[model samples]
Target: MEPRLDLLSTRAGGDLFTMLVSANNALAASPLPRATQELVKIRASQINGCGFCVDMHTKEAAHAGESPVRLNLIAAWREATVFTGAERAALELVEQGTRLADAAGGVTDEAWADAAEHYDEEQLAALVCQIALINAFNRLSVIVKRPAGSYRPGRYA
Candidate 1:
């Protein structure tokens, strides 16, 4: 599949992609665990059908020492036993957050309370931001039909 546009060369007033990457980097430095961050991105990308993001994040996660079994089971996280309670909560939030129309009244209070139980206010804030950011990137990639599997780990860094 051919990408409709080259996101790298296209400028949106002021190098929009760069600014987006900068924002992503800020999240990277947040108190949120790196593994959790990658898991959130991967889950959101999977739901959004953003192959580019899936490829990017999965590779990054592996590079950072995430287990292959866990990565492979991310889509089936509900039934997977590899994730911790906190990770499960984040994944739950990602699914609800990304599939808002499918979720009844959006993320459930039960899910929110579960996530809040595992994550502190700051971590919750970061998790929310991470979910929103990945969704935005996923939409862009899906809309543009961005080709997948060519991303190198740390390419944006």
Candidate 2:
């Protein structure tokens, strides 16, 4: 299916997306592990129901050597035995951060504390930024009705 609007074709969208992509690339250089970054992006995209992002990140993660088992278990991460405690903490943070409207207060203290246990200040900052950036990308794609299933690894790069 064709997109309602081609985000890349417009001048404003091109500039905005360039900045967003740059920010995401910078976050990738953070101390947070690459696997953790992919998980965060996938989880946030899943929560936002952004098919384009789900396709993009899942493929990218796989291309980067993420095992299918862990990728498949991301939605059930809490009960999965494959993930480390730190990965679990990051997943929890992504969940709460993405579903902020469902919670009475934004990102509960418990989640933040749990994340703190796994990540240092700088890593936590990176995590938070990744969460926000992925959510932003998800919204933009979902709203624009970007079709899924055609993304190639490093297509954007």
Q: How does each model score on TM-score?
A: 0.97, 0.98
Q: Model 1's lDDT to the true fold?
A: 0.94
RMSD in Å for all candidates: 1.1, 0.8
lDDT (10s digit) by residue, model 1, range 1-157:
9988877776682387777788999999999999999999999999999999999999999999999999999999999999999999999999999999996699999999999999999999999999999999999899889999899998987
Instruction: For candidate 2, write residues 1-157 as lDDT tens digits.
Output: 7788989899998998999999999998999999999999999999999999999999999999999999999988988999999999999999999999998998999999999999999999999999999999999999889999999999775
Best by TM-score: 2
Candidate 1 minimal-lDDT segment of 10 residues: 5-14
Clashing residue pairs for model 2:
none
lDDT of 2 at 43: 94
lDDT of 1 at 52: 95
Per-model tally of clashing residue pairs: 0, 0
Segments in model 1 whose C-alpha atoms lie over 4 Å from true places: none
Q: What is the total number of backbone clashes in candidate 2?
A: 0
Model 2 Cα displacement at 145 (Å)? 0.6
